[model samples]
Target: MSNIKSSKKHAIQSKKNNQFNKSRKSLLRTLIKKVDIAIIQKNKILAQESWKILQPILDRFATKKIIHKNKASRCKSRLYLKIKKIP
Candidate 1:
């Protein structure tokens, strides 16, 4: 509850932004999990496809600051290595 008009507007904007960010983060996590599941199943083609889909989404999120750039890079590196290890 904000008394000032500007404060109320800010509060509303904050709430909307919070929800938007939460949904984006959830989508990012789901994409990451899809890649991880493919890797765990040892399906190289599926893993590669999933990685192709996820990598750009991850970079986009990182650019938007939904997640840290380093975290996104680390996840990409680790997942790529796992995919490569699959024969």
Candidate 2:
């Protein structure tokens, strides 16, 4: 579809970036779900472990601009509160 050679290259690069971002976001969601499931199960140790894994990934994604900093902080805060509330 792209007539110019540079345009074609750009399209390919864009597609690659799109797939990479998609996978990264999916992984983020999966990790968050794992933490949530642990909380639902009332497993504090599991929740904490998953949180340990997820926290840095959230910060890293924010740092990479894949996700907003506020969003990352918000998720971390809410999840932490939920985990803490689990008796």
Candidate 3:
């Protein structure tokens, strides 16, 4: 429990921010999983499409510092490689 008024407000705001960040991270994971599933199913076209959608989402999260830039780039690279090997 926060004693000061400003501290209480900060606690409330922090909770809200935490929820928002969690949802964003969940959505990012879902998107990545979709692409992974498509790849596993050997659906080249579907994987390609999902990869296209995922790239910008990764970039946005990276820009917002939700995930590290290097992590995002690495994910993109790995996904790209998987897609390339989908033949």
The per-candidate count of clashes, in order, stands at 0, 0, 0
Instruction: Report the Cα lDDT for candidate 1.
Output: 0.93
lDDT of 3 by residue, 1-87 (tens): 879999999999999999999999999999999999999999999999999999999999999998999999999999999999988
Once fitted onto the true fold, the runs of candidate 3 whose alpha carbons sit more than 4 angstroms away are: none
Q: Would you list the C-alpha lDDT of every candidate in the order shown? A: 0.93, 0.98, 0.96
lDDT of 2: 0.98
How does residue 86 of candidate 2 score in lDDT? 96
Cα lDDT, model 2, residue 68 = 96
TM-score for each prediction?
0.93, 0.93, 0.92
Clashing pairs in 1: none
lDDT of 1 at 62: 93
- Which residue pairs show collisions in model 2? none
Which portions of model 2 show Cα errors greater than 4 Å?
none
User: Per-residue alpha-carbon lDDT of model 2 for 23-73, expressed as tens digits?
Assistant: 999999999999999999999999999999999999999999889999999
**How would you encode candidate 1's per-residue C-alpha lDDT over 17-52 as one tens digit per residue?**
999999999998898899889888899999999999
Query: What root-mean-square deviation over C-alphas does model 2 reach?
Result: 1.0
